[model samples]
Target: MTAVRNVHERVIDAPAAAVGALLDRLSAADDPIFPTPAWPRMRLDRPLAVGADGGHGRIRYHVTAYEPGSRVRFDTPPGGGLDGYHELTVAPLGAERCRVRHVLECEVRGAGILQWGLVIRHLHDTMIEEIFDNIERAAAGGVARPVRWSPWVRLLHRLTWARPRAVGTPAEARLIRSSVDRPDYVDAYRVDLLPGLPRDPAAWTGVLRDAFPVLARDDGELLMDVNTAGLTARASILVDDRHVTLSTAVKTDSPRARAYWGVVKLVHPVMARTMLRRAHRALALAAPSAGERAQAQSPAPERS
Candidate 1:
C-alpha cells in the first residue's frame, strides 16, 4: 500500500510563543484549524494522553504523543477512512518569527481509497493552505489573502467529482463568516469582481443570477446555494465600496459529506472566476456605453 504523505512548513509573523499560544488554546471539543476541517467541531473524550480515543463525526483517532506547544500527533483507529497518523509542531525562528510545520502520513485502502482519491487530497491541500492564511492574518492582526486556485487545478476537480452525493441536508448549517471571513469553512474559494465593474455588490448580482441560480438577492449581498456531486455548499456575493468578492464555504454534515464537498472544492476557484467573467461580459453587452449604443442604432449603409 502506498502511504500518502503531506508535509508543509510555513513561516509565520509571530514568535514561537504566539504560535504555541494559538495551538494550546484549542480544547479537545474545539476543532483546531490546523490539520483538517472534516469535523465542524471536536470534543476531547478525555484528557490529552497517549491511547486516548477522540475524533469527530464518523472518523475516530487516538492520541499517540503530546508535547505542549511544540508537538502533537494523532493516529487513526484501524478501518477508519484514514489508516495512519498526522502530526503538528511549532518552532521559534527568532524574537519575532516562528515556523509551523505539519505532516500527514497515511494510506487509505478499501472503500476509503476512493474517497481519498476523489476528495480528501483536494480538501486536505485546501485546508492546509487556510491554516497558513489564518495564521498570517492572525499574526498580522488583520485581513490576509487566501489561497488562489488555478484554472487547471479547478478543471481536474470538476472532472473527478461530476456526480452528486446521496446525502440530504446536514443537521444544521449556520450562515456564518467563511474561512476568508472566518474558520467555519475548511475549504473556501474566492474570486474578485472585475476592477472596472460597478462598486456596489448588487450591481453584479443580476448578471451572476443569470449565470448561477441565485438563492437570495437583497440589499448589499446575494447568496448561491448548491448541492451537487454529493456535496452541499453556499457561495456569497459580498462587496465593499470598490470591489466585490465571491466566496464559497462548504457545509459538511459528516465525514463522508465533507469528502463530497472537498472533491468539488478543488475546482471551486475556477468556477467562481469563470462565473464572474461571464456575467461581467454579459452586463457590458446588455448595457453598452453611449457611443456604442449610438453606433448600434445608426442606420446601416446601402446594400450589404
Candidate 2:
C-alpha cells in the first residue's frame, strides 16, 4: 500500500508526565474502556498489546518505544495480516504544556489505496478528533498560571488574553459587560459526563452544579450566575433531545475568551452540547431522582 503520513498536535496545559501517563492508558488490556476507546468505535476491537515481548493477535501491537515524559509507539497488524506500526509522541514545553504527534505506516501488496485510506481515517478520528478532549481532561485540575497576554494589555501586572482590562477591581466588570472578557488565566477546558441520559434543562442544571463546585445553578432563562475568585460569571445551558450547549459569559473582554472561541470553533461546534448531554446522563446514572430515572427509561425523542 502507498505509505502516507498523519500528524496532529494539541497544546495540553499539563506536565509531560501527566500527559504521558494518560497516553499509557491506551493499551490497558484489562480495561478496554480506557483511553477513550477510539479504535473500537472505528470497528477495530482487539486490545493494544503492551510489552517488549511482541506476540500476535487480531490487532497485534508492541510498545516499540517509550520515553518517560515524551514519546510512545505501537506496531499494529498490517492489512489485517501484514506488518504495520503506529507511533505517538509527547513533548513537554515547560509551562505545564505538551505537544503530541502520531505517526503510522504499513506495507501491503495490491492494497495500497485501502490501507492508506484506513490509516488516514483512523488517525483523523483517533488523533485529531479525540486529542482535544483528552487534553482538556488532563489539564482540568492543574493550577492556572498567570496568562501571557498578546503584548497589548497596557499594564505590567495585568495580563489579558487578547485585550486590555484593569484586573484589580470588581467595578471593572462594568466596562466589559458581555460574556467576552479579560480573563486572568485563559486556557481551553472540556467538561464530559457519562453517556445515555436525558438531555433536558432540569437534568442539566444538576450537572453544572456538580461539575463547577463553587458555581450555583438556579432556574431561569438565566441559567447560572457564578461567583468565583472575586469575579461574577454568567452561564446558560440549552438542552434539546440531541445536544446541550453551555454558554459561558465572563465580564472581561480578553483574549482568553477569544482562545476558547477559537478552539471550540475549530474542534467541533457541537462539542459543548454533547458534553452537557453527557454530564446530564452521568448525573442520572450516579444519583437518579425519580423523575430523571423515569425520563432515562423513556424512549429518546425522535430526531426530527
TM, every model: 0.46, 0.37
Off by over 4 Å in 1: 28-39, 47-51, 148-304
**Model 2 residue 29 distance off true place after TM-score fit, in angstroms:** 7.3
Clashing pairs in 1: 28-44, 29-42, 29-43, 163-229, 164-229, 164-230, 165-229, 165-230, 178-182
The parts of candidate 2 lying over 4 Å away from their true place are: 29-58, 78-82, 118-128, 141-304
Error of 2 at 232 (Å): 62
TM-score (C-alpha, index-matched) for candidate 2: 0.37
lDDT of 1: 0.55
For residues 1-304, could you state the per-residue lDDT of candidate 2 as single tens digits?
A: 4555556656666667766765654433322112222122111233333455343212456666666546667676455544577677778788666776666666655665664465434433443334444343443332133222222322311221111112222222222234445543321222322123344455566535445532333331224564444344555554433334455554434466545545544543244344544454345334532222223444223322
What TM-score would you give candidate 1 relative to the actual structure? 0.46
RMSD of 1: 18.9
- Each candidate's lDDT (Cα)? 0.55, 0.43
